[model samples]
Target chain A: MEITPTRVNFEFNPHVPIIMDSGIFKAIKSGGSSREQAIKSMYEDNKFRTQLSKYIAQNQGNEEDTKDIFQEALIILDKNLRNGKVDEDQNINAYLFKTCKLLWLNSLRKNNKIQLIDFEENPEELVTNEDLETFREEGKYKSLQKALTKLNDRCREILVLWSQSYSMKEIMKKLDLKSEAMARKSKHQCLLKLMQIIKSDPNGWED
Target chain B: MNESFYTELLEIKAQGKLNPEQEALLTSLIPQGSDLSSELKAYHLAKQAIEIDISNELKFKFNEWDQKKKSRLFRVDFKTISIAASLFLFLSVCSILWHSNQHFSNRRIVNDHLHKFNTEIRGVNSGPETLSDRIGKLRDGLEQNPTLVIQETQALLKLSVTGVQKDAIEWTLALAYLENNQNEKALTLLKSINANPDHSYQKHSKAVLDKLNSNWRVFLF
Candidate 1:
């Protein structure tokens, strides 16, 4: 099945430059309702999807890869544009494709795949402050997700409940434990177990 | 340092229940310029990951796109009436013709732009040789000394910025990637040039991209 943007909630007027003059970039940068609108707009844009699909296909990446690449690229572009890294006269569409290409290519390189199309090299170490932060968060998230997956169901539940701010008394009541001490011990033990798992995995996180 | 005290500190931190006295103690215990306790940091990270579900959202969007594509395929394949199919075929033919025309025009424009760009850049007076000079040299050495060129290009590219110099360096780096058999990176760079009409070396870059893509098609198909 080929991916296409078949559903558009509103007409996208190409004549109107939405990247700069409009508040879409600002909204994306601010993140919230405006960001959601920008994401939806990007998802609905036929050209944007096509560019992603084409590049992904050409690079031996799948549709899922396209989705991640597209989102990350948009985030970087949003941040860069806000910081004036992208010139005002530059075409936003071009910037999108360019950034997507670099990210996807970098992913391929990281995976140790030699297969790449030589369009041009990404000079100037394209990683941004936002990208570094995102990478750190991604690493931490992956490590944590892995550790959580390895835990017993009860331990996972206990830790999750504690993280969500349940007091020992509340947790004991909710989980039908014997006492507050029991809930506290269980939560503490669960945290220890999670930490152990994360620490054991050398590749779990990177600064 | 008491290990149990550290453990208790982490436990309270994870639960967001650290009192002012406990927080002060934690601040005192933790070495300056060091991160928060490792266990506590891990716990918090995992907890945030679970609560925010940022990774999960990525998966959700991918699934949505996949399902939409499948449904579209099913609809077009099984439910399209003969009249609609005929119209579709007609539109397809029209699209192909129009696309071919645009391709030829784009090629001409790219060639013209490259000629002008080359002329303009060549007119810039030569300055003292530096890292940019090495990038230029690597560009020339890409076919001759691919490994060394790639090494130099990567080093130089890391230090370059966005401008005519960086653009030229990127162009060379792309060539280095191609020479080093990293076709994916090369293709990506070429695609950027092809897509951006206002790129510094837009014409020459796109021309190279077109050639490479054509070769790729032959190689793949």
Candidate 2:
């Protein structure tokens, strides 16, 4: 006797758990085109900029200062997101405002216009100390990127690809190398060269 | 393991592509006290740092937007500056007009005091050769022939006369000096008359002195 197979239909439920990769955190994790879209959307959104500008203006800052602080805050935010220092559910606007406020305060401190202890009191509970540490790490990354530019095109290409997590086999095929060993050796030599360059200019990595 | 072998393992480990056996092998090869651990850490940091890519296109977009905002602000600043300049000019013009009117009014008061003195001289009538007649002659020639009035007033003052006649002769001499452009002599005579409390021309002299002293422009016109 032949048996007929029954069709099992599953209805969509609103309460069911769905993984949505729509937020800035997920976009940054995805990198490439998605990361660009996320950054563009965040930049074009006037709410964050307006709030940040208002905060900076109230704290002895001008329009130009606001622009600088906002741009820097956006870059730091992007870096922190990419580094997994920011939580997925964190409010991007609030995070940006706090970052801008801290950056401006830091600038004021650097200029001797404010005491460090004065702005440190009652720090926002939303931005943890770890998040602030990421800002400093972001500076180091900037210096590293600057050092990366001094290398030859071939070295930069290999190092960039390696840094992007391309396997040895993939890197060798992409760069038309003879073998994985050659790719590894080239990557190691390029890194060593990069380190040498960084060592030559000790002050370059101080940031 | 050799340097290249360990570096390959470390790179794989950084990429999170190492299997359990490879991870164990890397851990066993590079002990915690080994210098390769620091190398691995540095390699990881460099990888993470270089992965942060901020596109130049985004930076260019932001700079373009900033330039547009700055140009807008500059346009607003120029308009504000123009309005402020216009206001400053208007206030300056008004101030000048007000000062000119004040100077003109002061000059008119001085002229009125001189006219009152002339009218008083004309009102007084004694017969010919009297102090009143001599003062009348001085007043008549005060405008055109002040030199003759000065000479005659000096002659009249040398004679002993009544208090009223003395006051009239001194007043006429002062006016003659003023008409002859001898303002120092005129001011001296007027100050003397103003210092005398019982003199009949004391109040008129004080008024003319006040007007003359109020503004130097009064003397120019």
Candidate 3:
């Protein structure tokens, strides 16, 4: 059976378990191999793919655009989950769809390519306060990426792992640290250096 | 709250392992409306942006798409092809050879200027260690490594030196740059020398510029 966007049934297939109902969020929060596995499953899921394709088709978007928006939405969702911003009662699939749709609309409005009818039929302003928040988030993400390039390769790697919520034991093993303490110290130092660099740059945190 | 407290709170928040009591304490200490809370959220977002890796499936798909695009762009049907492409390719090769010959012929004039500068006139040695010795070394170095001579001459120009000494170094550097196939840099230095009325090498620079401006073989044959 071809999976439709609204088809919530995943119990028939014992091979690929469903990532609905906060399961994927919990996997991502757990970090390490679990997060990687969760992301891979999401990407390869037929239902998820169909949902993305359906959403993109409605908005005059292509496969490439759909893939990019889906990936970005996942990252934002994961960030929100980690920051305790996501409501516990929210449905993951619906949340992902809505966020991805808004992101695409924001992108269209940003490039001024949205047709007059598209805007008129919607009636509400496309450039809402939420779009402004997304814009600010994207801007900060860009600045953070730029600042990351300024760091040493080793420091950057350590911080990346640390940011993903890797345990000190895992970090020690990965980086060949002498002990968990060494990993902790290195992570702290690298994180501090990154924060200092970002804070010093006015663009990273605008007044 | 202090910056350190906020930093630690952000680190803990990013880890997503805060217990209920710890979470309650954090919420009580730093309210949702506080800038510190906003900063923490921003840090978490930045961390997420950095840590998240794209899936291998996406990467493989991108590679597949790229290869398909490249093949589509370069695909040609031999039976239905025109001879214009072959003719264009042949003409392009001939044009490139002609341009390379023109470049080499122009380089010969610069070589001649170096030969004349080394043999006919002597560099002023009024400064520290005799300018003639340095020029001789640079000339010999040029024979082996023109790029090295260019760098050495540029360094010498940075030194605090007299009028005659500076002009001598600048002129040599211009020649070195020309020999290095950097015609624009050579033209710039030569123009500066020619523009300076007090420069001892003004006449020689103007003469070189005139020849360079005229034709590739103006000074030769």
Candidate 4:
């Protein structure tokens, strides 16, 4: 089998715009410490957290609410960025704030909590309806992930490496498989087993 | 295609290693609304779920960081803080200017390539409304009505298509995505085309990708 060598680069240039759907973003997709570093920077950035805390507070939320909403916003942002839903030039801070606002509003509406303040912001400025729809779709993945945890350790390891773009040769070496073909077959079986597990659960994939 | 062939294709796809020809073959072989297609969708969902799993791990790490940060004590001198603030301001200004220039240049380069692609499509669009002609029209319609073009191209992909026809349609669809400012989708399609040695649009796709990568490298370094 002719295996293309995987490109491995450890250098993370802090100057590159991490929001751009290229370059560093591609590095993040390929998965490594760079992705972790980028997420850490976003998490630790006080400006975004401070702005969101103030917004949530003004809208009748407490400190715990601010932290929870902020964390959810970060997840949404990270998912959108990975899925290419975010545009290159879009303001990340504004996007996160808008997502938090929308999520909080949905939560309040669900709880039948009386509105403390009028959120008269332009609807267009909020995250797109498509983004909300995508977020809904993501809820299914959480269930699927529950199914994933049921897989045996070796199967889980194989599937994770495959998803991370590891080459068959590397997987073969790491797993002590006889050949690349065996590695490929192992990944295929693991995926099929995961699918079977998901299918077996009556409530596994319920939307 | 036979059952084994379909299974092989699905396996390759599950590995995320399907070349363009194999992708087209799988599309042609799988019956619409069949169990096979659902299985393929399951595989896709599983892959996405794994990615979400990875992100969740990161979220766990973030929680750890939050706890650790809360527990840590910080002490800073005013002079040190002042010097750091000054340096940050200077670097921020420089970074803003550099990023603006890079963004502008990258946009210009992308526009130039799209213009070239438009011309090429027009040259191929003279015939009647076959698969290629429909793709050509979709490319032409991208500027005037991108949403319609995107819808039409997506619908077109559902129909059974030959390998070369699939390549033409996908290339045009990628361009339409670019026109619609969906860079991620466009990049995915372009990379697929460039990876497949037998893909009809391989050369053009490579050229565009090369330009894009060069610009990214310039921005990175």
Candidate 5:
């Protein structure tokens, strides 16, 4: 039978059975496995992309951080689905709730939280805790964006377009740089100095 | 504030790659002298203002979310769940909270439903005399052929003696209690209805609960 929301009474409270069945024991104990399989399949569903995208787009945060958080949540979901951490009689909604909460707490706690998630490493995964901090700083690139304006008009135009994905050749042609290589390296030094000024007031630019 | 330190950070930060040791150095080296401290404070204030600006946008999204959740009566579908998760994370990324206004309403719904229950039940007089009289009848009834289903039905309707059986006979009695605005009795029977786990009227019970939670407004309507 298809389970419905009204069946959320594994106990009266939502948090109860989560504590009771957290993956260590009762998941695939004896006969019940199909339910577990169905739950695992449902857990990794990417169908919610629209809602996730809308929420991220609407928020003030950098899209990259939004991506980080969503990615971690997905990773957690995949790991849990692979493990016997689920039961057919279990509440998938509650499991999602707890999983999301823990992932969020991990996001808050720096890289330390990664170890807490009991999982085998995915080989292609390059986004680590360090990468999260990097994304965080990248999100604060706005500080540098603001600081670049402190430079003269030519510097501002050159830097803004560069930040916006203009290539070195494009910037050289556009800004009338001495040469392509000069534009590339000088633009680098200019941006570096500009970022220095921004980072000088470190309290404000925290990612 | 030297160019080299900034360049180091810019390179790694631009790559969006930093080990803990490097990040530690960057964070620790942020000067705290009087001039620098004051500048940092101003920047913090400016950042707060920027956050407020962004918060307005987040609130719009939150309200949209609230409306969607209200319409959704079934399971927390993948869409809704993901939106909630992403929104929560995005707000965190923004360093701002998008608290659901539902906290007050969620609590209020729970309280008012419980309150309506209390008011309707009015409890056969909260006195020992009434209690003893009811106890005596209940004891004698127990001695009789245990009308297990009937008792369960009565308890479910009363919203007391929860986990009662849901037989048709019991339901008739429960319907009677509901018609009479004997909400306490109805609630007890409803609790009994919970035992089936797969009862047909489970949705009906939830709808009734939502209606009841609305401050006795159902009766007025």
Candidate 6:
């Protein structure tokens, strides 16, 4: 069955100036814009999804990679691709290409595919913002998500019960603890196991 | 001593029961400051996530590792591929030079025709003409002058802030011609209002571009 998508989204990378359609812009700027509005506005406007997805897929990436790329691009664009510092106009494609190229190039540098020396640069690239709140949020969320995935099944269950604000008495019956003391003991042990896993993988979390 | 101590610490944290001394003692045992309760909170969350799914950690929608290995395979021939690419680039350069040679003669022939057009048009259009016609005359002036024409064309394509010379694009082109003593071409370009408004050329350059399109030796050159 064919599901006809009823919206325009995804344009090219923002470097090439591939001119945006005016109609979509109107929908994006529709009245009463809040956080909820912007999320929905994604469907009604923001026509850059297909191009971005295709680029990732062509590079042998998947939808998950596509999502990561999209999110990272969003954060970086908000951080860097603004203020008319670049030759940005209404051309979403060109703007996307420029931003996307920077992303791909930076990723390449991280992966050792490209050099990091002064090939090209702007002063704004360095001092855009001191706090990368969006990136940090994603990092914290993803770390928690990943650590949860790495738990043993029993440890996993106990953690879940404890997280739901389950009391020691409730957990004692559910996890078959001998007493509240046992459930408490198991919960702490389970939590320590998770912390150990996280500590092993700590990249930015370390002081 | 350590086993029961660690166990009691876990139990004390688990039941949400802690004597002040026990809590203080637990804080000393854990190396990451006294955030034992917070650590347990985060750990509990991760455990819940695992209970939901293990594929969350170990699974990918695509054969990512396999694809990465394939890309790695290509790295084996990096030197050979670079050499091959360099050779291909050399051959492509040779072909372009061969092609440009063919285009050069065509450009020269076109320049000759443009020169003829310059001389003929100068004879016509005596007085105040339409705005569009003046623009046309200016284009004709710049075209007759090779230096001015090249500079103007370069500016147009340079993709810089200075490229858009408001209305003086033709005048700049005209200046380029005047500098090269292509007075006839400069005369045509000056006739255009758009050409006159370009800013890079000096007043002298503008005067030279606007000087009567005559056949006398441009001794200034």
Cα RMSD of all models vs. native, in order, equals: 35.4, 17.3, 26.0, 38.8, 28.3, 27.9
lDDT string for model 6 (A33-148, tens) is 23123323332223465666677566545677665655554433332332112233345445444455455544554455434444445565422333222333566557767766
CAPRI-style docking class of model 2 based on DockQ: incorrect
Which 10-residue span in candidate 3 chain A carries the lowest summed lDDT? Answer: A7-16
What ordering of candidates by TM-score runs from best to worst? Answer: 4, 3, 2, 1, 6, 5
State model 4's lDDT: 0.67
Sort the predicted structures by DockQ, highest score first: 4, 2, 6, 3, 1, 5
Model 1 chain A is weakest, by summed lDDT over 10 consecutive residues, at A5-14
TM, every model? 0.35, 0.44, 0.45, 0.48, 0.23, 0.24
lDDT (tens digit, per residue) of candidate 1 on B1-221: 34336557865776688999998887666544545766566655555444434335544664686688789988777666766889999999889767655444423333344344444444541443464455555545656777786677667667755667666666666666665667787778878876877767677777766765574334432
User: Relative to the true structure, how large is the alpha-carbon lDDT of every model?
Assistant: 0.60, 0.66, 0.65, 0.67, 0.44, 0.49
- For candidate 3, lDDT tens digit of each residue in A65-169? 887777667666665665456665666776666567667766766666553332322444222334324334667667767777777888887876766667889
Over the stretch A1-207, how does candidate 2's per-residue lDDT look in tens digits? 333332211111222222223477777655555666677666656655665566666666788888777777776776677656678887665566667776776676556554443233455555554555432555665676677778888888787666444668878988999999899889878876775566455554443
DockQ winner between candidates 3 and 4? 4
Deviation from native of the Cα of residue A89 in model 6, angstroms: 26
By TM-score, the best candidate is 4
Question: Which sequence of candidate numbers ranks them by lDDT, best first?
Answer: 4, 2, 3, 1, 6, 5
Looking at model 2, the pairs that clash are none
The CAPRI-style docking tier of model 6 reads: incorrect
In model 6, where do residues sit more than 4 Å from their true spots? A1-48, A51-103, A110-151, A157-186, A194-207, B1-221
Docking class of 5: incorrect
Model 3 has an lDDT value of 0.65
What does candidate 3 score on TM?
A: 0.45
Candidate 4 docking class? incorrect
Cα lDDT tens digits for candidate 2, B1-221: 15556666877776578999888777776635445556565665555445443423446767776687779999999999999999999999889767766654533443465577656655653443455665766676777787898898788777766576678778777777766768798889999999999987899888767766766545445
Question: What is the C-alpha lDDT profile of model 5 across A121-153, one tens digit per residue?
Answer: 445432233322211354354554455445566
Worst 10 residues of 3 chain B by lDDT: B49-58
